[model samples]
Target: MASRCIVLLVAVLLSSLLVVSSSASSSPCTFPAIFNFGDSNSDTGGMAAAFATVSEPNGETFFGEPAGRYCDGRLVIDFIAQTVGLPFLSAYLDSVGTNFSHGANFATAGSTIRRQNTTFFQTGYSPFSLDAQSWQFAQFKSRSQLAYKKGVSYKDQLPPEEYFSQALYTFDIGQNDLTSGYVSNMTTEEVKQTIPDILNKFTDVIKSVYGLGGRYFWIHNTGPFGCLPYVLDRYPLRAPEVDSVGCGAPFNEVAQLFNAELNETVAQLREAFPRAVFTYVDVYTVKYSLISHAEKNGKTHQC
Candidate 1:
């Protein structure tokens, strides 16, 4: 899994450059910035700002201080940024003394793609829904324009074409949306029926960003929820529900269904936006591989 991760990061870096270089001739292929949206999978700080409980041990492994990231070390986004020679992105909610020149993270730990009123379940309300995250990005754009107009420092300005248009826009969401529904006692069929609406909302968010001059997108499908420690602990699988490797069959089947729809949606987006670069990353497969070969990957436990 470590080797696979390294290869994946390298591919991300190269593919980003390929997309940029293919679009323009005079400019270099390096990504000037990266704007990411999602939940805890790639959240850098939005969770910390929204909740006080996410502190200390959360970031102690690498940062030595609470950095708002859900992982002990760096996430896939961090690796992508480093591979592309960009600085680690800051969460938009952590605006104090943070830099947005390299872009910002709009993900929160418990954020969902569906807005509060639109969600299928009565889940906890969070202000960082996909709709709200798009609004925050709009605000960031407005502030950048205001700074440029006021002749503020160069670092404060967000050049439309040079930055937002050329930067890599990434999304890694929808896990919580399905999980929340399942935990709320919604049947699998009920959850499956909501997928089109969920993808519709997700499409709207992508179009909104595209309207804001985004031309490159890296969308990550949801991972295997059945293999998650929390899910495994909470939902004890029956003999038929468990796979040969011990992962929950029903949960993973739901995940694969979602990924299939997501893939089809990406294909449609490619057709809709012919000039744009849309890469659908199979995060589920990679994560599932880690779970299947845990000892080889040095992953002794699930988390």
Candidate 2:
């Protein structure tokens, strides 16, 4: 399974650069650190630190203990870190025994691109939206620099000043933004209407990071949430609304639409910031293909 994951990730990692460069290069480049922003798909436990720790079964399968991630083992972000020769990112919200020298994760379990009006307690939507995570990154950069300058002792745990500009900034959010709209009893059209504002806010946050010296960006488009039982149960579909593999068609349509808009947004971002390197990963294509293939059998898969 680990090997399979590595192959998949490496494929995506290589594919990500295809847009920026004419061809993918085999040569290696090292990033001193990684700054991640996303939801559960890449969260290293911001939600647990802010609210409650995820217990047992969450990490027992592969990690041998609760490692603060939402999954049984490491997340996609973890694999990316290992692939890049960096340590796993500590959750920015997790203060206990965390090391920021390598990088920090600002992703929460229920995070969205746009802030939801309802509380997490009410709808399980995170208050730490994409905009909020960007703010946290800004604060962390300034504060960690100050801490690093204090002494050599503090330098071991904090990142250096130069690492800020050289580090890879990764994003794996927007899935929850679409799901949040659905969970709020929104119609499909209503959810589609929110994409423009959401992408605009996403662009704004990217600009914020760019202003702070972040130059390299790796962004993952939202996955296929329509195949999940959680979404299927809530949004009871009509007979015609079910796809060939029995996934919610309307929900998947909305997700695809979101990915398309996000792609355009990335194009615009590249134009706006000519100096920055942007890698827009097509996670939706990979995830949807996997889920559809799995559903052809009697099984279901979740990202």
Candidate 3:
């Protein structure tokens, strides 16, 4: 199930890049770099740096050692970097051997789109929420500018305009937000009401990136949370509440509702930034389809 989801996301991102490259007559490194923001789904090594629990089997399938990725192998973002002729992105939180040349991963596990004053599920405040990530990005931009002004070469320093203006900004978030709400016992309608605030923070991130000269944006909406192994095991539904595919219908509906609003938000962003390109990938549909035909996709696990 994990492999299926990761592969689908990689395919969608690569396909989108291909289409853009073809139309613009650009190569794999069409953009100067890629700046990614998200949670565990796209985190490369943030969790490992911040926590000691991530080790061993977490990255053994591919790296043969712990590399901080939640999965046993490379993430979709790693594949996207490979497809674009760039090296794997180094997590910003990683202090050693950190390379910010091709861009950096600002995603952290358990990150939320909003900062919380109260604890959720015994989890304290996240230091790398969407807001905090944006601030880190802004700091990166500042340092890059300062480095450029000090006569540093491109290889040794990050060029502000070349890296920021031409970079592909990608986001894959909001799953944790919904998860927190559900676990906190919020009703479906209450969770739905939180969508606007979540999206507003997303919008702020986009606008902040735009101000930093970002013009290409790839936004991924939340996937089928109801079908995840964790959710399936924790919240078993009655017969009527389960879908034909054995997923919890109510939970899936909440995800769909969030995706719907996210799509609309992307459309509005395109209008607001006429010169920028915004692509909203329908991740939920792609993931759900793979789950529906698990045998055909070589997925044996129910999740």
Candidate 4:
């Protein structure tokens, strides 16, 4: 899942954020910093900072220690930073050894676009919803500037005032909103009914960030979570409900519907904010294709 997501996001981001011109120029765009807001997909260490340290095996393959990421190595956001010649973003919630000179990440594992009613202990969802993240960014912006003025020692730890406008604001979220509906025992149709409100909340955050001098936006539509083991194991599906790739078809269908509406939402946002550059990347298709082509390991057994 991690590798496939990396491939899709990196490919799309490279074309949109890295490509210089149509005439084969290799120069990447000069994005001074990256202000990211999303879930575990792009979370560097927000979850660990807010809750507890992410233990071994999570970052052993990359940093040789738990680096706050849920994956074994780098995330799509990490690649985005490297591609743009910026350092990995520090989590806003982490106070240990952080550098916000480049940018700060507001994402957390188990985060949802819309605020969840349940607690983290109850539903495994982060309370730092998209709205909360936007608020954090706002606070970070104001506080960092004040801190940056203190002395020369603070200059390298905080971003320049202009970096907020020059930075790339990336988003990869909303999948948990769909699953949260399911986890709460809502029907597929009922879950589908909530997408508009969820996206409205998403739009509100984007608008909020834009109002705060963010000009560039990179949004990723949710992927096919039905194909994941968590869903398949937790929610039993009949043989007829399963697709050729063994994913829950009903859930994938809902995801598709959500993506379709999300695409329209981005278009509407583009129209609503003319000056803000919005690049919506479709990760659902890439994820589903990769799942379909994936092979089973030797340990597989049929029920």
Which candidate leads in lDDT? 4
Which stretches of model 2 miss by more than 4 angstroms?
Answer: 1-27, 295-303
Clashes of 4: 0
- RMSD to the hidden true structure, all candidates: 4.4, 3.9, 3.1, 4.0
Better of 1 and 4 by lDDT: 4
Query: What's the ranking of the predictions by lDDT, best on top?
Result: 4, 2, 3, 1
lDDT of 1 by residue, 1-303 (tens): 001122233334444644554465565557889999988777878867765546656666667877777656667777777766888888888856688878888987778888655432234435578988998998888778777777876645354436888888889888877876776677788888888999999999999999888898989888888766667777787798889778888888888999999999999999999989898888788677766776676632122
Positional deviation of 199 in candidate 2, in angstroms? 0.4
Identify the runs in model 4 with alpha carbons over 4 angstroms from their true place. Answer: 1-28, 150-152, 295-303
Q: lDDT of each prediction vs. the true structure?
A: 0.75, 0.80, 0.77, 0.82
- In model 1, which residue pairs have backbone atoms overlapping below 3 Å? none
- For model 1, the stretches where C-alpha displacement exceeds 4 angstroms are 1-29, 117-125, 153-161, 300-303
How many residue pairs clash (N, CA or C atoms closer than 3 angstroms) in each of the candidate models, in the order given? 0, 0, 0, 0
Quote each prediction's TM-score.
Answer: 0.87, 0.90, 0.90, 0.90
lDDT of candidate 1 at residue 279, scale 0 to 100:
83
Mind giving the per-residue lDDT tens digits that candidate 3 earns over 1-303?
Answer: 121244644465555654664476445446668899988878888767876547667767778887878777777788777777778888888888887878989988778887755542366334578988988988988887787787666536353557788888889888878867876788778888899999999899899989888888888888888887777786777899888998888888999999999999999999999999887877788778878887777733221
Candidate 4 lDDT tens digits, 74-147: 78788778877888999999998998889999999989988888899888899999999999999999888887
Consecutive 10-residue window with the lowest summed lDDT within model 1: 1-10
